[model samples]
Target chain A: MNQNYSTVAQRSSSVLATNKVLRNTYLLLSLTLLFSGLTAGLSMFLNMPPMTYLISVISGMVIAMFVLPRFANSTAGIGIVFLITGLLGFGLGPMLTMYASLPNGGNIITLSLGGTGVIFMGLSAYALATRKDFSFLGGFLMVGFLLVLIAALANIFLQIPAMSLAISSVVILIMSGFILYDTSRIIHGGETNYVLATIGLYMTIFNIFISLLQILGIMGNDD
Target chain B: MDWMQIASALALGMFLIILFPAALQMMKNSPKAAPSDWKAVIVPMIIIVLFIMLLIKLV
Candidate 1:
């Protein structure tokens, strides 16, 4: 009886912990989205470019992300959020401008958001229900991602539309795998911290959303 | 389709990829009731913030 009770207690505690992490992550994610949208609007109002400078900024931001995890527990995390928000805001300037300038700008945003929503709902469900170990995908996805990056950089100078579209498609696929992998990690006891899980899941969602937007832009002329 | 959107997405995507693992590692290694010190989040955050500011200003 004592042993059974201990097991029950352990299970309940873990469930409670998972619930807490999921709740916090969702709250923070929403807050980040709100801030991102606001910054995007502000940048558009300030007449920021939709390209060039954003590329450089993003490059810098990527590099910073590498460095930030080393300081995850400090007040520095706040600074990291500020930086991410700023970059995200700047990044949105172009979309914001396009949306405001084009007749179908709102459509583009809506479609992108909707597409992201669908992917998240579908992939997350799969992750939760499926029994396959997605961690095996980490290596393959990394290789594919590297190739995509190289291809993307090469295209900047080569100026190939087809190549860009192809890269975007692959990115969408790769990021989806990441979502499955990350979520499964959490479910399988591979990831125990909600903060970290949130970051992983957030990245997966962010990429998936952006890639969907790219695909929509390439295939649909509604915007 | 536009260059800016591509660049922005790429930048955000890459940063999160790097941070996600680090955040996980931090959590995994941390002890209960004494979350490990996260001094590592500074460099990337500051770098990213500066970049974002610059992007906003220059773009």
Candidate 2:
């Protein structure tokens, strides 16, 4: 009887801890997303120049890889996450502007945004509902990410439209995988740091949105 | 190559090289737990494919 009581208590406490992490991660993720959007909107309003690829990549790497990890256990981590997301968002302004310039650009943007939202919600809901341990995908996702990164970099020099489309397609798949993997990691207690988890999920969403936009843009041009 | 091309190449090369080892390290450290349900993986992938098809049809 005593053993049974302790087991119940332990399980409930574990569940409560998991719930707290989920709650905090989602809360912080929402705020950082909004902050990113605001910065993007501000950049658009100001007609900021398109961020050069090199600068965006370098700055993104510096913040995400170098800075965020060091501060991830501290309160300052949240601020650094904001800085990374905001910079990426500002970089998005010019891309959005370019899309808005197209003939059916507004429609394309709307469809891509809607599609991204649907995919993110669907995948995340599935992970949370099932409470699955998707950690096995970590290895596969990392490889996929590396492949996509290399292809994207190569396409920059190749300037091949078809290759760009292919890269975007692969990226969408990889990002979706990341969403499942990251969310499941959080639920299963594999990841306890909400800040790091939030950033991972945020990056996944960002990549998905960008890839969808690229695909929609290409298809719009085709029609 | 021009300066811009050179810089892009160098940055991209460095990023990729750094990423490879980092990813390996991450995988090494990740928990070695079997997935609870394969359907969780399959369903999301199917959804992604269908969604992409829908987007392609939209434009």
- The best candidate by lDDT is 2
Model 2, B18: alpha-carbon shift in Å?
A: 2.0
- Across A114-143, the per-residue lDDT of candidate 2 in tens digits comes to 898898888889889887778888877898
Q: What TM-score describes the B chain of model 1?
A: 0.45
Cα lDDT of model 1 by residue, A149-207, tens digit = 66776676678878877787677667776777677677666776554565566566666
Fraction of native contacts under 8 Å reproduced by each candidate: 0.06, 0.52
Sorted into a CAPRI-style docking class, model 1 comes out as: incorrect
In angstroms, how far off is A179's CA in candidate 1?
1.4
Q: Against the true two-chain complex, what DockQ does each candidate achieve?
A: 0.06, 0.53
**Model 1 chain A worst lDDT window (10 residues):** A56-65
Model 2 whole-model lDDT (C-alpha atoms): 0.84
Query: lDDT tens digits, residues B1-59, model 1?
Result: 67655665566456556645655554455333312212222232344335323322321
